[model samples]
Each structure stands twice: as C-alpha cells, then as structure tokens.
Target: MRLTRVTTAELDRLEFHAVRSGEHAKVAAQLLELANQVDAGSEISRAELFVRAGEQWEFTQEYERACAAYQRAIDDGAATVVDARALRAGALLHLDEIGQAYAEFERLEADEPSSLQTYLHVAESLYAHDDLAGAERWATEGARLFLDQVGDPYVDDLLQELLRIRFRIRADLGLAEDALDRCTDTD
Candidate 1:
C-alpha cells in the first residue's frame, strides 16, 4: 500500500483499522513510511501518527519503541499531551525505570492537578512500586478532589476504586487497626 497517494483521512482510517484488527506491526511500518512522505510543517499530524505508532508498539509489548514514539510525540507537541506522558511513564515503568516513571507522573500531576486520571495514575504507579503510604496519600487526595469538585455519579466509581486500593495498601502494611477504623467509618 503506497500511502503517499492517499489522503490524510484515508491514511487515518487505514491505520486505525489496521491497529484495531491486530496488525499493529504492519500499520506501524506503513505509518513510518507515510510519515516520511508528509510535509515537514505537518507537526500536528506527524505527532498524532507518532502517538498511534506508539500505541501499536505498546500493544505488541515493545516498550522501548513505545517510549521512543511517545517521546517523539511529546517533542512534536501532540494534542494528547496528557495521554502521551501517561503512556510514556507506563512504558518507563515497564522498563524498570522506576525513578524516571515517578518523575514523569509527578510532572504530569503538577501540570494537570485537577485531572482525576493523573491522580489515579500516580496512585497506581506508587502502589506498583510498593509505596503503600504514597499510594494511600494520593488515593485519598484524589477521592477528596473528586468529592469537592466533581459531583458526577462517575465520581462514586472512582471513589470505590480508591477505597479498594486504600484498603489493600492498609492490609499490605499490616495496619489492621486502621483498616478496621476505615470500615467502621464507611459503615
């Protein structure tokens, strides 16, 4: 498929279906070739293509390539800055770059303090790294933020997840008394 002759919309459709149908590697290669053919001034389009390439790489379990693609997206100022950063942090964590991942999450949190997604990602990352205290702190903060700012019913779902994570952290840390107190408070 010589995508050079195709319109941007066609390329998008092809790439989307290709990735969705589990032809990530093939789609990524096609995207790379198509990217080279696009004008240099198309930074936004290029960034989006790179992000899609990163997603393909991630789906195929290629963490390094995914991270590189996400970084390229970041450099190009892709529209999905939050998503790209989050995926990059996740890729870094998968690569065992714990410190770097933590830094990325922290930077994202600072940049988007009101974002529930950022809070959840930070808390989950901390939990994965066995930082129960940090996880609990972030989860609690997120729950409070959700309660104070978002009156949506969806906030309850998030609160439930946070509560579950907090309970797990408390149990893992041997804080049975605290856990019992939490249960009582909930009741």
Candidate 2:
C-alpha cells in the first residue's frame, strides 16, 4: 500500500495496528519507504520513526539492523532516550558485545539513578554475564530503594523481583546462608 500525504499520527496508528496484527514485515517496509519519502520537519518525529523501525527489526530478530536504527534514533535525540538505550544495550548483548552493553546500561543507570527499571536492567545484564557478585549488589541496592515504596503495588512487584534475583545470585555464589540471613534481617 502506498501512503501519500498521511500525517505522522495516522501512520503511527496504522503501524501500531499492523504490528498488533503481526504484519510487521509489510508495515516495516511501508514505514521505511515512507520515512524516505517524507520529511518529518522535527528531529524528534524522525527519530521516533527510526525507533519504530528498530522495533520492527527487533521483532524479526535482526539485531544488527535494530541496533543501527536505535543508534540513529539516539543520534537524533529521540524522546525515548532511555528506551532506545535499553533496547540498544539488549541488542549489543545479543551480539556478544558485553562491554558495550554494560556501558549502555551503566549510562542509563547514571542518568536515572532512582529508576527501578534501570537497576533491574543492570542486574539482569550482570547476571547474564555470570557476574553473580555484581548482580547481587545491584539487586540488593534495588531492593533497598524499593523497600520504602512497598505500599505501591508496582513497587512491591519490583521489590519482590529484586529480592528473588538477589537470592538466586547469592545461591549461585554459594552464599545461600548469607542471603537467608539478609532476608531474615530485612523482615
């Protein structure tokens, strides 16, 4: 389908629907063609289009293309900076660029110190890299920060996940007894 003179909003809606319906490749091709045909005027909007393209590439497990798209979005200063960073980091990890992936996650964490999601991402990266000690440290820090917000259901869920990760990391490191003691003390 050739889309001509359609507003970006309209295109976004169509793309969303297409993705939801699993017509990702078709929609992705349309989006790429459209991106080349139109000038979005705003860097942010263009960046968003690139990010969307990256998402489509990711759905197809094209990590290299996804990383390229995400990097373009980042370079354009897209509004989804954190999300782009996280996705790019994940793509790098899948590509076996562990150091680069860790750097991206660290940058996200540094920018959003209070973000539970950032902490979780860092912990998960460490865990995936077999750095049990680093994973446990990050998970413990996340749990500590989340403890005060336990009344919030979402925070509670995050806290629980952090605790679970910490326990698992400790167990993997043969510090299960220490993990038990820490949990007991926290309770």
Which 10 consecutive positions of candidate 2 have the poorest summed lDDT? Answer: 178-187
Best by lDDT: 2
Candidate 1 Cα misplacement greater than 4 A, ranges: 1-21, 26-53, 78-83, 176-187
Instruction: Name every residue pair that clashes in candidate 1.
Output: none
TM-score of 1: 0.61
Per-residue CA lDDT of candidate 1, range 5-114, in tens? 43567667866787579898778766656655655555436666777778778778898988998888778774652366766887888899988887887787677556
Superposed Cα deviation of residue 5, candidate 1 (Å): 16
Q: What is the per-residue lDDT of model 2 for residues 27-115, given as tens digits with 9 covering 90 to 100?
A: 76666665555554533365666677777877787889889887987887746523677668877877888889879877866775566
RMSD to the true structure for each prediction, in A, is 5.9, 5.7
